[model samples]
Target: MKQNIYHQFITKKSSGKKSFAVLIDPDKVNAKSIAELVKLSIEAKVDYFFVGGSLVISHHLDECIQQIKAACSIPIILFPGSPSQVSKYADALLYLSLISGRNPELLIGQHVISAPFVKKSGLEIMPTGYMVIDGGAPTTVSYISNASPIPADKSEIAMCTAMAGEMLGMKLIYMDAGSGARRPITEHMIEKVAQHIDVPLIIGGGIVDPEKAYLNCKAGADIIVVGNAIEKDFSLISEISAAIHSVANVNAG
Candidate 1:
């Protein structure tokens, strides 16, 4: 079994360290691509691998986990879109609640149905408050979750929402712009949410470049997650990883 993954997050947050995670949608990558990604992730010294998508219509979830496990020891965290996405092969599962949306199903309905299986799977369950922010375009996450994102410019709303999630005992708070977003979440919004929450803040979606990753880290994101961009250009793993780790290095100096 993998070491406690949530504790790792807490430790990194407390120590002022930043992490980079590669998000792999099971339906998007095959064995060959997974092998390539795992190789790049190992070389880049990536901190984590977030495995899942908004709509995973494939049966490759377990296979994907196994492939990554076969090549490297980097922790695999299941960022599942639904109850059916769980796998015992992962080191942890981000049991997400869509706090930005009013949809009852995503907020709690799915959790109830997946509880027993998740409990039995032995995967470290990290309850997370997941918020979707407007990224200048409609996204699959917003459409599938049936929830409207908090407007991109609403920093106050994002701050309050993160505070509520922390108050409710969420282990982490994740604000995403959704896959293939036209714009990334603003640094101001990230700073606002980070200032308001005590738990680790995870920022994802539309981060396509090393500069954006670096800026997000400087804005107080504890973990920067990149998916579609990395899928399009696997070489980004090294560049973004370097950018995120550089923040910690600078802080240490």
Candidate 2:
């Protein structure tokens, strides 16, 4: 229901204040179960909810979003893997272009197909340049997207890719190590990209603990996203949320 969602996020994070977000991949949870999790996530002080996945198996994307929206005050953002994963029911959509991959479908072709629907749906669209790094494992996204990830160890290549994306007018730069990644994106990579780009930096995938989240924050990540970890333990949202906010508050004070 909220408009100007991208600006809202930017404004919300001002003054070094951090927020907690939970990524809901519809492929992982059903409507009934997701509602239950939303309630628990709210109790965890999670700042927002992100819904989408590499492959959408759920028949109830809009319905699930509406159900969760009714249960929590947290804003829901769409993190679509393909154009079809989009639903107009959420607050905003992260319009991601996989800069790490040479595949034109993810880069622009898919966006072209989904653009009209997105605009007509009245959802806020935040243009983002998404770069997937080769985590320790071969992720479903990498497999389905059929694109190679930038080497996790190559900071210069990552920086150049991110810079090119920004030059092309992306609002945010997201670096994903892919879901269930054996390792999270390194602090060094985050620091390298953060130093180079002015836009918000979103880092997700394989972040399983608060310490790792703290490391991303320390490396200058503006927003951090976690999904699979919370799926394994609903309580993790609270634990990691508390850790990130505590660190943010400490730094601010």
Which candidate number maximizes TM-score?
1
**Candidate 1 residues 90-123, lDDT tens each?**
9999999999999999999999998999999999
Question: In model 2, which runs have C-alpha deviations exceeding 4 angstroms?
Answer: 1-3
- In angstroms, the error of model 1 at 43 is 0.5
Each candidate's clash count: 0, 0
lDDT of 2 by residue, 143-207 (tens): 98899999889999999999999999998898999889998899999999988987888899999
Model 2 / residue 113 / CA error / Å: 1.6
Best by lDDT: 1
Model 1 poorest 10 in a row by lDDT: 1-10
Q: What is the lDDT of residue 15 in candidate 1?
A: 92
What's the lDDT for residue 169 in model 1?
Answer: 92
Against the true structure, candidate 2 reaches a TM-score of: 0.95
What does each candidate score in C-alpha RMSD? 1.3, 1.7
